[model samples]
Target: MIERTVKYKKPSPKPEKNRDVRLPRLYKSLYDQIINNHYKNALKTVNKLQRLDTDNEELIKTRIFILLQLDQFSHASSLIQSSSQPFAYEHAYTNYRLKNEHLASQSISPDSDDRKWKILSAQLLYRQGDYKSAIDLYESLMSDLSPDTDEYTDLETNLKASKECLDFHRHGYLQAMDELNVPPLDVLENNPAPFPDNYKPPAIDTSSVTVSSATTETPSKLLKQKEKRRAAMHSKHANKNMQIDPERWLPMKERSYYRKPRQQMSINHKRR
Candidate 1:
């Protein structure tokens, strides 16, 4: 009878939903840090989670939260490859990634508020050199063109670019004709002097209007950057004109290899 006797072990109490032994108190601490706006501290907690876990929703969620806060759209997109919950953080991150890839990519659900970040992502996508994507996003919001009007503005910009390309390509043949010293027959018959050899348009001293990309650069603050750039450009250009003598033009707004033409104002910053 004594040999048959056995002892039973009691089961452990269940941990809370937001916290558990598996997740650890560290996550709770991270949450507190997040609430306190201590993002750096929260990031440390996330790092600890990464070291221990292999693949888990909680860890993914933690990473997502951190990435979104830091605006690491590309990083967050990679972490959450595929998830079932559409409304989950992973879904949002996935949409964000897709949007960045192409503004018109159908990442958001049907009933999404395009005005919400869902639309902003499109602008960003274009700004980042994804023209095709940016165009797509603008097309979808044809109805919501009233409020932000970003869609309309962006659309007009894209249209102008398209027209410019068409014009350039269509007239490209003229350059070759002119280069071969082959003027149209009508001109040759009517005028005694054929087009002058080494004949060139008076170096078409065009005052090109620069179109700068609203850059995501060393912005003191995101909202104020554009305003500041505009103000500075105006001042520089005006001052340059006001001075008795203007030196070289200020730095031009350079665009990435593939993107919209960055318009810059040739502002003279030198004082009169």
Candidate 2:
């Protein structure tokens, strides 16, 4: 019988999937840092994660959020601008914060799933003083968005603020001043006639106009007569302000006034 050489086939080694195990732990660290408001630390870890998976959408978004939290608005804007594909929310939001409204509107893709883009767009309109457009958008969003959510709260706040602004624009400062029973700002802005023609302020009796004794004197007067008297008290008592102790004030010889020299101890004295 011819002995057939049985070639032993070595088992194929397991695929190098250990990298997958580290993914969640790394993400957890990122999450923890963010939740604890360790934005700078979170940003460092996020950069590391992005390096491992350069195309990670979530990592990119988190990095943008971290930059925003750290108040690095320009950096966030640059990162969005450098993206290979448009991330509508990030791009629009960063541009919005940068006050680049036109660019933000351009960056907003109509097909984007993020409703935040629409919210940002509406907020841009609100900020640009376009209240009607903003209110319409916000009202529509309010209908669809739940009131308990932050987005809804923001929408409601912006809507209310926009309405107020709208009212102000409609009625104007003069009308508002009249409604609130306050003087109009224009009255302060315009130069008053030095004196009305042939009209003079009535002469007042200076002797009868007494200076107010209260601390709430008009700013034109630095100090009333009573205030001057009170302020002068400090200078008046300056000599008496010294902290001389009564017991220590007794007369003594000049030499006794100084501390006595420490007595020299006799180190070699025999016990007596």
Candidate 3:
């Protein structure tokens, strides 16, 4: 048996690492756009990044964030749904923005440590007329948040608003208004008068009224009116003739009104 030499084939370099070389540059551009509040441009960059790395969870999150910044809650919600990674806070927030209270409440993780989730929960409670719960959440947030920050200030305002809403709902002010038979300001503004839909205005009886001879126009009065109209026409024609100027239709600069003193006819021409 003759021994045959077996040649080994060299392995080719993987192109996967080379293809990712542009990813960092794209990421930097995306971050720059986001930082400058250019969400529309950031969204475009995010799309390009997604195409390059379809399975990147961070890219999906970034794209969803950009969509939210652009107020595209529907698109963000759909993206969240299609994504395998769970975006509990984003999903809840998108549902909240969309006014889907049930979905928002269901998706929100109340026990999460994220402050934004708590704020969203409080807002949802307030929307649901649970002002007491909202107030409690806002108070807790106020205690934890630093007083110097804008978030703390906003929370303070929300807490006060929640307290006011709670007081309005719990107090007898609405009952008093109802007892007094007074409509709310919104009702008064929207419908100033509660006229019946089927009600019709009374018809005027013109047949019963007669035109008196004194109010009727006589032949002499008709002649006088004709004379006045003739006089008006004559006066109008006279005024038109008097005001007529040959240069009236000319360009402003070429008109007599704009003529130079030296360009105007001299005293000899005027005399002629």
Candidate 4:
């Protein structure tokens, strides 16, 4: 019997396990940090994540958000500006925080339908003293939001403030004063007299007028009398004792002179 050479096929090597196991752990760490409002720690974790996943656009945005949370608006703005992708809202928000209204307005698109973008736009309008536009935007947002939510409460407050500002601009006391040509006290004092230069006042006769005794007294005499009266008043009240509670209006616990009684400490011993 001719022995047929049975060539055993080489077994395929087991598929290599993924070597980069730190990616998932880093992601979890970053998420936990962000959730706990630990932006400083989150920033470090995000840097690691960015290194591991260099192509992730979301990671870049997350870093910008972390910077914002840390109140590093300048850094966030620079990062956004340097990024290849457009982050209009984030860029605008950073500019807004930096008080660069012109740059913020230019960066934000007017036609964008994003709610946050709209809210930022409204805030920009409010800052620009465009109360009517801000009020309209706030009112529209309020209608869409439930009253129980915090966002709705904030919108309501903003709406009220904007309405008050609008009213003040349209018919406020200051505006009324301006319309009536009421000069400020300082301006009135500085300007020429309201009467014409040619006008003159009639002379009055002083011989018939009778002066009061108090008015006729010399200033030195008057001052001496006042000092004498003050001395007598002080002497009258000098011996009076303070009988009423000095802190009568204050609560018992809030009184500075009041102290809480100390409790006696008792130790319990256990028998072995």
**Top of the candidates by TM-score:** 3
Report model 1's TM-score to 2 decimal places: 0.31
Total backbone clashes of model 2?
A: 0
Q: What stretches of model 3 exceed 4 Å from their correct place?
A: 1-21, 182-272
Q: How far is 167's C-alpha from truth in model 2 (Å)?
A: 0.9
Candidate structures ordered by lDDT, highest first: 4, 3, 2, 1
Whole-model Cα lDDT of every candidate shown, in order: 0.61, 0.78, 0.87, 0.88
Better of 1 and 3 by TM-score: 3
Instruction: Evaluate residue 195 in candidate 2 and report its C-alpha lDDT on the 0 to 100 scale.
Output: 71
Which one wins by lDDT: 2 or 3? 3
lDDT of 3 by residue, 62-101 (tens): 8888899999999999999998888888998999999999
Could you tell me how far off, in angstroms, the CA of residue 176 lies in candidate 4 after the best superposition?
4.1
Tens-digit lDDT string for candidate 2 (1-272) = 98879988999998865767867888899889989999988988887788778777877778888898898989988887887756667777777888888888787766665667677778888888899999998898899877789877877888999999998888777675667854567975795647768897889889987676666666557547668878777775476667865556555434345553344234334333
lDDT of 1 by residue, 1-272 (tens): 45756777899997655434646677678779888978777888888776666566566676677777777766766666554334343455456455543433445454666465555555555545565656566666655566457657766676456445446647777677668967689988998976878888666545785656656345557658677777876655466445552323533434233333334222333332
In the predicted model 3, the residue pairs found to clash are none
Q: List, residue by residue over 34-55, the lDDT tens digit for candidate 4.
A: 9999999999998878877898
lDDT of 3 at 138: 88
Best by lDDT: 4
Candidates 3 and 4 compared: the better one by TM-score is 3
